[model samples]
Target chain A: MELLGIMLAVLGAALAAGFAGSGSAIGVGIAGEAGAGVMTEDPGKFGLVLLLQALPGTQGIYGLLTAFFAILKVGIIGGEPVSVNVWQGLGVMFACLPIAIAGYYSGIAQGKTSAACIQLISKRPEETGKAVILPAMVETYAVLALLMSIILLNSISF
Target chain B: MTLETGYGYAVSRLRAMELRILGKSLFQRLLESDDFKDAIKTLGETHYAKWLSDDKGTQNFEYAISMELQEAYDEVDRFTPDKELSQLCRLPYDIHNVKVLIKGQILKQKGSKKRTDLLTKLGNVPIDDLILAVESEDYRLLPFGLHRVVPESLMLWEQTHDILSVETLLDSHLFLTMRQLVQKVGYKGVEAWVHAKIDSENVRNILRLRRTGMDAGRAIEFLHDGGWISKEKVLSLLSEPVEGWNRILGFADVSRVFEGVPETGNVDDLVSDIEKALDNYITDVLRPYRYSTFAPENILTYLWSKEIESKNVRIILVGIANGVDKESLRRLLRNVQ
Candidate 1:
């Protein structure tokens, strides 16, 4: 029974991190690609786009951290015996959900901002600060997800 | 309270105000005007005309815009009742007031220029009084009586007299205020957006300072105290030749458009470009969202959209008045996203 619980925990962590991080990776790539398009047209907004692309990357980090903690709980770190009930497994799964969902949508939004930032740069390169700001505005949700997940995990007993 | 009730009211109001934003035709028409007065006349035909025609028309326009912003903000407050949102809306007014006072003082030092252009009575300390006040007070790192500068900003400002330093202090304060507000509200979304804007603005300011033959030290002094670009990088950037636009451009891929500016040109255009860029950013980008069942997104969006319209009108009014060529005037009109 304990071994089964351990397996569930490990799998859950891997799945959570893998799926959510992948979404973030894809999202950041999309935003970066849009930024690249803008750069090609005007080349001056590189810094602003970099910041925008980076905002989406935070989602991936949140996923990875959650998965790492799950793995530790399952004793993946020291090879100690691990135990988890179904409730714990469910907790892990739900905790990872926010990043996966928010990351996917934020990536698309960030991509659109990257395109706009490019247009902005082409016309008024001096205001790249505002361009960097637009996409960061979307990533707040992912950060909130990471924070909430951490709190949730802390509340649960293994 | 239900999330629907909390979010519904503000979002609906924002959407309605959003509809009133200047469409492309107005931008195009104003762009076609020969000068600022012509542009102002055209603008007078819009909803903004009554305010523009007041005895102190310019001040009236500024106040009317502030009132419009306040109305949009009130809608947000009605829905969410967030104190931070109130503070956010009021911040620009606070800063504008300070800037006006400071500029007025600076000019007074050089002998008074007309104080009419500055927005006073918006709780902007009277220019003469502000000068007397700053002169009497001990200049702390950030200086006393600064409504916003926290300890860090005070430190930075105390260290440098460069305008960039003052800017850095303000930027830092803005970020600090924003971050704390986000944490307090448990709303990370708005915080991220605010930080990105600060970073972008920082990079732009650095380039502007550098282009104007200002040193990194001066830039640091003027650098808005908070941003992603560390002071060290700015120092190195200042050492580069004016022709080294590519080096600055390399810092962020989004900033590549800055490289397109003519190698030989007035720095004023760069300042205008930065202003226009910020305006487009607030209006065109950022999807609105609900957080903690409050409508921060709607409030900020409405506030920013209104600001862009007012700025566009101002551009038109000034252009038409100057009798500038229609083609040139059009090109000068900032794209308000």
Candidate 2:
């Protein structure tokens, strides 16, 4: 039972990381597609758009780190078999919540910013700085989500 | 707002929108294009062509870009509900328009043939009315929100003797207003960007002053009051040679752009690079709130993007018409996005 509990926790953490990463992957993929379209029209602004698209990708790393911490430091795997309890399940669920939510939204928002950045770069490859101002606005929340997930993981003793 | 509801819809919508931007390799192709006509043809075959009419000509590319930008801003604004944020989006253009109007006023007063035709497309303010207003109206002539600050800007400008000093003062005033707006709205990301812009502009102004051999006092007077440029730093750099000044300016990251230009040459490209740098910063660093309505940053980003796209197409078209070679035109390309 204890072994099953440990395995469950490890699985939960992996699940969290996988889902969050998927969200980021989808968001970045969309931005990449849009960026390709813009580049087809005006290739000169590629670097700027590429950087904007990268902003949404931060969440995937955050999710991975959270999961890694849970499994490694917290001994979610390769430990004494402890029966998986409701509290442990809730901990795993909530631990993944911030990143999953942040990743899902930030990915989409970053994509929009990337598209806008691509359009701006296409027109004014020189004024790419001005184009970046708004996308960075969206990046803040993603960062906050990552921070929250990290902090929550750190607090969990499981 | 709780996690379950607050920004749910907005985030989904924004995420959907983000998936639509362009990529890198295409930029190389556009840059490598032979001329503006070729660039337009290439773009016409892309997704952006949807925004353009089937009859959209290279001559009207910038206008089409502007319409697209306005539409993007509108969509963002519709998604967000912050009025102050919307107003902030117009601040940069407002300041740009003000500068254009002031320059026009001065030119018309001196009976110069060039009456600020560069900004005829903006149509935000009239040259004639601006002239009349500046000459006859008090600070009260300014919009209600800006009336109080007009006196401060006027005083700063009055104390400056040279053109550089006047320009710096005006910029300081505008920078202050932008900073205030960014702060009031609690948009720290945009705030950082605005500060960076002000810092870049101030550093550029200092470089111009050094090249002109202006006295230390005069140079200090010319410095924009509240940018990242420290007074002591500028004073120290004033005593150094061009390369030394470049090193200090390079520390600011904006100086690397002026590397090729002669110290005495026009700083036209510097400003252009600064604009590009700010745009890049905005696009990469900031992300709009998921459920929040579009703010000032969104609108400003949209507007700046359109303006640059217009300028790029114009340059490309003009180069094609003038029979400029692809290699030469490449050097002229703004190396931005």
What is the CA-based DockQ of model 2? 0.04
Error of 2 at A103 (Å): 19
- Model 2, A1-158: lDDT tens per residue? 55555566576577668866876786676566656655554565567667866766876887787778667644545666344455665576576677777776776766556655655565456777876777778778877877887777667665
Per-prediction interface RMSD in Å: 13.3, 9.3
- Show model 2 residue runs off by greater than 4 Å: A1-158, B1-15, B18-22, B46-57, B83-86, B107-165, B241-337
Residue B165, model 2: Cα distance from true site in angstroms? 4.3
For A2-98, candidate 1 gives per-residue lDDT tens digits of 6566666666666657766766676566556555544544355567667766766776677788878777765778667557777676676666666
Give the Å shift of residue A34 in candidate 1. Answer: 33
TM-score of 1: 0.52
Candidate 2 C-alpha error for residue B247, in Å? 5.8
What docking grade does candidate 2 earn? incorrect
In model 1 chain B, which range of ten residues has the least summed lDDT? B1-10
